[model samples]
Target: MRDARPAALGVRPAALGVATATTILLAGCSAPVQLPDPPVDDATRALCTALVADAPATLLGSPRRATTGSLAVAWGDPPITLACGLPQPAGLTPTSQCLEVNGVGWWSQDGVTGTVFTTVGRAAYVQVGVPNSYGNTGDALAELASVVADHDTLLRPCVG
Candidate 1:
């Protein structure tokens, strides 16, 4: 992503040159993508609970938010990107998928069949999908189970 600064900010030519060079220089560095704060909702909250229960340490113990019909979870560490085939629109091979617990899409376009986890704000996202390999459903199931565990935290305990 390119950072577009205003050209009419009274920036002198020398300053603009410096800014442009600085931008280029910064772009060379691998900077983690930033996402907006996530919103809390019933569904997302439930999901969070399940995730925590499944694997408390897997998640960086950060608050999460709901966004665009999905729960967003961010991480305290640098987000990870992988080729996870998340459900997408039919016939549209998504360039990539991004997951952030705090309601932010954090996936990037890469030609691999793996899952990518991302973090936005204080939350993180763990994505699951079908892999290009065979007979690995057990692994997938285990991953899903871990994610489902967080749901326990997302939802209020049933009155019993």
Candidate 2:
């Protein structure tokens, strides 16, 4: 009875093993993460395409997941999604602060899914949707920032 209690509270050892195996299998055979393609001009599309292509294959130790299109991508189980060539963040203002991650500027907002970060002070707006399961999004942002810095034009310094 006591053993059963532990299993109910957490999970049975056998069940845990099965779940782990299933996770591994699902990782390899994952459906593409679907994100809305933003409406942007040809020049913005070109910029975003370069940034998306330049993004690393891995983020926060998780391999990039299959995503729907060039405008957006995702990674890991919970799926950290990145989208480029977006409109300016609605919450942002002239006085808003931009946090620098690996020299790229990002402005953040707490959303239902997690923390949503939009790139500031650049030629194109880039958004990263990070689920709370990933904990600190900084690690994930740093890698993506490198891609942005490489591919996008810097218009103004990231305002701290």
Candidate 3:
């Protein structure tokens, strides 16, 4: 008597098991991200590249994610992102509250998305965008300030 199994379904049971296992293994894998590149001039671009390259491996106990194009980095699942070579904040004024972290001066503002801190009095403006989930923007800025100061020249110190 001829076998009743369909010829099209001839795949070995072992092969099917292997394929299922492979799929299960890959299900939890996450692809690395590339953030939107902000506009930057030649001078600023150079500084940005240097800053990204020198950024620490971890910030606030979150591992750094791979990034490309202009200067950008992210950490943690919610992802605290930092972008360099951005335009200076137009709203910034002499009276704008400035905070010094790790010897770098930053103008901090809370936005709907999160708290944004921009380097003040630096050769190139750098912005750090911390999601509201992070909760501690000060620590993030403190960890990042050294990297910013390494790449950009400080024009003036934070006043008041």
Candidate 4:
């Protein structure tokens, strides 16, 4: 008997095989990055929205990617993720020393996975997490410094 499997399925044999292969290949691909959406007050949200809108289209040579949260933005594979309107970090005490970049104050704390730098003494809190693979946070922070300073109100200046 002649093969009628493709005809019964209403598709050509070659097309059916191609479609199956495409699906299998796509299944192995990863999804877009999803940033956490932390709770923020109304004023903070407004500031974050403005900052996000004015944020750079590219960072650290990587084109910006669409992130899941409104108050967050990311760039590149192994993304450098930025989240705004975060609560004050416990480590940010009166004595905490921070890096001053483009007039923006950032507190840097390194972890096993990566280094997380959060803006200190701003009206609205902003956090940027740079993975270890990215080498260092300097370039990333410098790129973002002006944008963060322009949008987020500086409550207290950071020291170098």
Candidate 5:
């Protein structure tokens, strides 16, 4: 014996409320938040050279370095080469273990100086000095990892 008039007229407040709530919920879940790109610095040139030298023979020469503020990046393949700069080999303090990622050597300074080294290939390595070195180590390493991973992809395409 329930009334069918409201359903027929399409005036159900509960249905409208549900629709409005769903719309608002979807709006909140729309898109992912993105982090801003790190800045590039003038010293990135040196960093690129060191990294690219390590590229596999197939990569010839392809590392490019760019720096902004305290962050430095080295990228490229084979002969192209890239680097932020080379840190002074003798002056590094409390040197940490060198991490081997995909056969490439990556090192970091564990102090406030925030210096880092990355091997791009067999005979190439690059150094970088970052600002606020203490807090930025993770960011610096992540950036290097991204470049290294990309190089691997270029040299060895994913089959799956």
Candidate 6:
């Protein structure tokens, strides 16, 4: 019986090998990272788009992942995700601990899963969901402060 491989079908063996290798390489390189798309109003959506465009390529020292069609960004394998235009945090109070970093205010609330930090007093709320493993929420918030400030209007400042 004659050979019945790709070469026997008038295709070069080297070309077939290269094509298979290229396919595998492209597949490995093009994996998409999934992230949550927080719902927002039209005004907030516009602000979120601006924030996303200004977001840094890295967060907490990890390379920013390519998020799948969301007004959000992530870093690391199980990423530290930041979703903009979230509804105002229900837990915020007059006395809630707020920190100012690079002229932006953040209200932080700790939960079992992780620490949630929201930009306080901004016209549109931007939330950063930092996992417990991250250890330093401050750095992530600091990195994001300018982007949030540039895109959203401050309604009030963090009080002492």
List where candidate 2 sits over 4 angstroms from the true fold.
1-29
* lDDT per residue as tens, model 4, 1-160: 1211111111224645554344224323433445546778888889999999888999889888766679888776566778888777665776688888878888877654467788888898788877677886799999998899899998888854
lDDT of 3 by residue, 1-160 (tens): 1211111112113544454344223323533333546666788888888888899899989888654444777666555667777655667876888889989988876655467777888897777767676777898998987888888899999884
Poorest lDDT segment (10 consecutive residues) of candidate 1: 1-10
**lDDT computed for candidate 4:** 0.71
In Å, residue 57's CA in model 2 sits off its true spot by 0.9
- Model 5 TM-score on a 0 to 1 scale: 0.31
**Would you list the C-alpha lDDT of every candidate in the order shown?**
0.30, 0.71, 0.67, 0.71, 0.33, 0.67
lDDT of 2 at 64: 84
| TM-score, every prediction | 0.26, 0.78, 0.74, 0.78, 0.31, 0.73
Error (Å) of candidate 4 at residue 75 is 0.5
Ranking by TM-score: 2, 4, 3, 6, 5, 1
Better of 4 and 5 by TM-score: 4
- At residue 93, candidate 5 shows an lDDT of 27
Measured with C-alpha atoms, the lDDT of residue 158 in candidate 6 is: 85
Clashes of 1: 34
* Residue 133 displacement (Å), model 6: 1.9
Show where candidate 5 strays beyond 4 Å: 1-88, 91-96, 100-104, 110-112, 120-122, 133-136, 149-160
Instruction: TM-score for candidate 2, please give it.
Output: 0.78
lDDT of 6 by residue, 1-160 (tens): 2211111112223545564344334334644434335567888888888888889998878888766646777666445667776666666766777899888988876645467777877897777767677887788888888888889899999874
Clashes of each: 34, 0, 0, 0, 34, 0
Q: Give stretches of model 4 more than 4 Å off.
A: 1-30
